[model samples]
Target: MNQNLVIALAQVNPTVGDIDGNLARARAVRAEAAAAGADLVVGGELLVAGYPPEDLVLKPAFIDRVEAAVEAFARETADGGPAFLLGAPWQMRGRLFNAALLLDGGRIAAVTRKYDLPNYGVFDEKRVFAAGPLPEPIPFRDARLGVLICEDMWTAAATAALAERGADLLLVLNGSPFEFDKPDVRLDLARARAAESGRPLAYVNLVGGQDELVFDGDSFVIDASGAVMARLESWDERMAVTRWRARDGVWVCEPAAVAARPVGEEAIFAALVTGLRDYVDKNGFPGIVLGMSGGIDSALSAAVAVDALGADRVRLVAMPSPYTSRASVEDAAETARLLGAKLESVSIEPAMQAFGHMLAGLFAGRPADETEENIQARARAVTLMALSNKFGHMLLTTGNKSEMSVGYATLYGDMCGGYSVLKDVYKTTVFALARWRNRERPAGALGPGGRVIPERVITKPPSAELKPNQTDQDTLPPYDELDAILRGLVEDERSIAEMTAGGFDETTVRRVWRMLHRAEYKRRQAPPGVKITHRAFGRDRRYPLTNRFTDLA
Candidate 1:
């Protein structure tokens, strides 16, 4: 074999329930690897039914379908070419097990069960399948390979057992979601595992967005000495092939060099575009539609939509109200023009006046209040829904995480959409991305070519422009301070006492903590958005809405 053993890792996007399509993709990738003369090829975790299958894994019929698919796939691999290691659920002895199937020459080589099914933070594997026994190393062609599923490599005992079992290399398949610096975190883990076990490591990750999760495909292989040898590109469908040579009885992996990683805002922007595109295309949606506001959030969402779906596929409607400013109207039109998407201006002023005039008697002497504001929002919602129904487009919402967290968004107003683009992004990140997208060209941009957002959109003060002279800071804290507090409490899990001790104003912390707790209902009803962290609302983080527990704990 040319004095080397070649291995290929395929990180391709797969839809959740599209069983036949996903299987076709797997077979196609396997054929590609075989064509490349690879001795072994690996797919991401749960290749049959896709990852984070959630309640679908609980159904007996779905499990049967998965088993049928797995068996069929194993049979197809009998062409006797390269060995294949893939993920699937194994129904055995009246109990379901999260499993990794090893296929060679059209026969079942080994079925390894995952030991650690992550229970917390964007994972509910524990709820779906029973944990399997510790995995054993499978030997093939002068090397002992240890196959571990997504959460199995995260635990100590799994890798420890593999090390003690005289394994020559560690290969892990994952459906890990994307977050800032998540790739670096995964690399650090890989390095540590390699150094600790004194073996080379191969990490193959899935690439796609399923519902709220966005899987970033930045797979890599590291040497026994804990050095990266090969890295696949981020948020892309990359197939990498490398050879390992047993030099002096030590398995050493040699891979081709790849390009550098993206940085900061560019990195995040790329992830968003990739996530949105995959979610839309893989889900079989015809196109996307959203109300175009002049705010940075909508402007940036439009930019991302154009980058994800072509401009022709993204329909923008400038739905204005009495509260919408002239500058806002101009900016919204400008954003649509820059994105090259079809634009239609439907003034909500007439609808607003009609609703107000109709409800004048019921609201007599009540004066102007949040109810009035909400009515304005609902009218716009009806109009948007009408347009969406007539045009057969998937409505895209533009609420950012900060506004979602604080319950600053109206339920039937800005929240009435099929998909949310910026629901996971904080307001601070929204501003940064708007500025970066305007000043810099994002990776994989598919719009008219130059900068999508104008400089004035980023330079201008952040506002909803729902009312005359309206600023977000009027009702909400500064974006910088609010994002800091959220990261502390939400991500880092800092207690209220700890947050106050960390230099935050005491009253402010307590007040914000209450708002976060009270806003649970709002988040519960909001449409699912991209999840960039280990913990995201609706799926990952399940805080009790009626609970009395406070951050004071």
Candidate 2:
């Protein structure tokens, strides 16, 4: 029995349904860990088949392939240098379970199933996987290692049970998705469990984007005292190593390199970048093309695109309509110049005229209203979509969450795109992020640093510019008030009266509430975007399109 154990956290990103590729990554990382003198290596949750295989796990053939890959991984350990603990879905007695496989000495040593199945907020594990009985510690070399899946570690009972069973250390495998401030929340949970169990805990999280969910791998290790011993980088992939030693009859992880995690808008910005990069790259898009409205939203979106896919890969089109101000056109060009993205000018006036002439007789008696405005937006959408098709570039929509919240955007118009980078970002937060990116270029940003977003764009009023003297505030409340009300209604799920009592106007709150409800259908059809906040439109917060229920009081 070795008194000292070295563990490596193989924080690799796995694509959903990529069994062979994921197994190759696991094997390669294991070889790296073995070279580093690690006694054992552990990967993130469901590493072999990727996290949230969704309905793919329901197929028997997929499960068989995953199990075969796990066996192949086990065979690689025959060199006897380091053991591997990885995750995969297994079927036992005709029941599917999310199990962790322990491979040592070239064979599968033991298997432990996930006890807690999370069924809320982007997770439907209960539907796909059967919850196993409480997991006990598994023997590895000379140490009894307690293994817990993602959701199991959130509660104390699992870790406490392992401690009572005389587990030497706790290892948690996670497919945790990135949300604002989630890293802190995860560390707090881990610290609480470590304190209760009086044992060192190592948390390894998956890193990469899967559909709308982006897994920020902020893998970490904490000693018995709840002090963070080692921390891995977030929003990127890295393999981290932690050394553990038994001291005074207690196993404690020694101090190691701790990477500083991004906080607030920094983390959110990184999430948007990672999510967009993975969504575009993984889906095999040649590059991205987006309409640069010269407004804060599009400016920020272009900046993010440039940062994610590089300036050469991002194409900026300034589609000015009859109402499009000269200032906006100039601003859009300047923004493209600043970001070094290729800017093309396309006038939507011809399309607008074409649509107006086509609808003139039908709309002859009716006063020109939002219908006319939507035509302009739709024209822009058509031009962008044409370019997207011709050049094989993914059209990036630029609507922020505030507009998406209140049905403020035009369907099949501004909302037409393969992805929306700022779909989950509020208008106020968009300004904040624009300011942040101007001042600091965070790690992994490929764009040029220093004032990339013009200050005028941030200070200018927001508008759809659909009509004369048009601004977002004319149809909706001011962004500050609107975002506050939205946070309460959407994220906090507060009643209208609750929001009004909290210093918001009753009329404004009710109006916002109505708009939010009316927008459900639009959101259902909108393209998937990166989720930065606690509650995003698609998965995190789901609302019925036909619901007549209102919380307005």
Candidate that scores best on lDDT: 2
Cα lDDT for residue 39, candidate 2: 91
Instruction: Specify the highest-TM-score model's number.
Output: 2
lDDT of 1 by residue, 1-553 (tens): 3346899998978887767778888888888999999999888988778877888888898888887877788887778778888888788899888888888877788888988888877788888899998889998888888888978777768888899998888999998888877878888888887888888989999987888788888888999787789888877788889888886657888867664777688878887887788778876777888888887888899999998888988988888887788888888888888878888888888887888899999889887877878877777788888877888778889999888877889998889888887888888899888877777766667866677787677778887666778888888788899988988877787899899989998887887788888899888889878877666677777777788876554
lDDT by residue (393-431, candidate 2, tens digit) is 999999989999999999999999999989999998999
Residue 367 of model 1: what lDDT? Answer: 75
Query: Candidate 1 — worst ten consecutive residues by lDDT sum?
Result: 254-263
Off by over 4 Å in 2: none
| TM-score of predicted structure 2 | 0.98
Tell me the whole-model lDDT of each prediction, alpha carbons only. Answer: 0.83, 0.90
For each candidate in turn, the TM-score is: 0.96, 0.98
Clashing pairs in 2: none
